[model samples]
Target: MAQVYLSLGSNIDRERHIRAGLDALAREFGNLSVSRVFESEAVGFDGDNFYNLVVGLHTDLPVGQLAARLREIEDANGRVRGGAKFSARTLDIDVLTYDDLVGEFDGVKLPRGEIVKNAFVLQPLAELAPQHRHPLTGKTFAKMWDDYDKDRQKLWPVHFPWP
Candidate 1:
């Protein structure tokens, strides 16, 4: 089984969607290593704050199939398509990385660019897989986070309990 990391976020009915998303992930993947949920102002758009977190799992499915499954979960939770690039989302999930593979596969970019650009994605990822090195950069997630400019964005952990 290949190790996969995923980023999940929600703004509309934040708590409900996040919980549902996590539940779906657990049901589909069997087990999940999840990080603390952080609340942060929406980036790249004007909207309600979002609750974001990262999850790690082991899956035997191919990258394309995994991406498709995640999209299904998001859609089931009311995710809309063909909207503005960044907008209010009931549920959003992206494939962050698939093992140590580099470049794009099955149209999903490995080591997603947002991993380095977005605090919501990187922070939880760093916390969950601090020692896992980036497939391309070869730097540990913890190291990249340490070097990240925390001032670029503001995010804080909230009380998010999961089963």
Candidate 2:
């Protein structure tokens, strides 16, 4: 089984969508290593705050298939496609990394670029897999987070209940 990390977020009906997303993921993947949910201001567009978290799972599915399954979960939870890239979302689940695989594989980039650019993605990811190195940078997620400018993007942990 390959280890995979995914980032999940929701703004519209935030709590409900995030919970639903997690439920779907756990059901499909059997078990999940979840991070504490963080509430952060929406980036790139004016919108409500988003609940973001990272989840680690083991799966034998290929990269493309795993991405497709995630998309199905989002769509089931009311995610709309063809919208502005950074607009509000009902649910957004992205493949952050597939094992230590690097570069574009099966059309999805591994060690997602957002891992370095967004506090919402990096903070929770670091909390979940602190020692997992970035496939390309070879830096631990915890180290990346420690060096991150927290002031650049505001985020805080929130109470979240899950199975």
- Writing each residue's lDDT as its tens digit, candidate 1 over 10-48 gives 999999999999999999999999999999999999999
TM-score of each: 0.99, 0.98
The true-versus-predicted C-alpha distance at residue 106 of model 2, in Å, is: 1.7
Candidate 2 C-alpha lDDT tens digits along 1-163: 9999999999999999999999999899999999999999999999999999999999999999999999999999998999799899999999999999988988998879999999999999999999999999999999999999989999999999897
TM-score of 1: 0.99
Which pairs, if any, clash in model 1? none
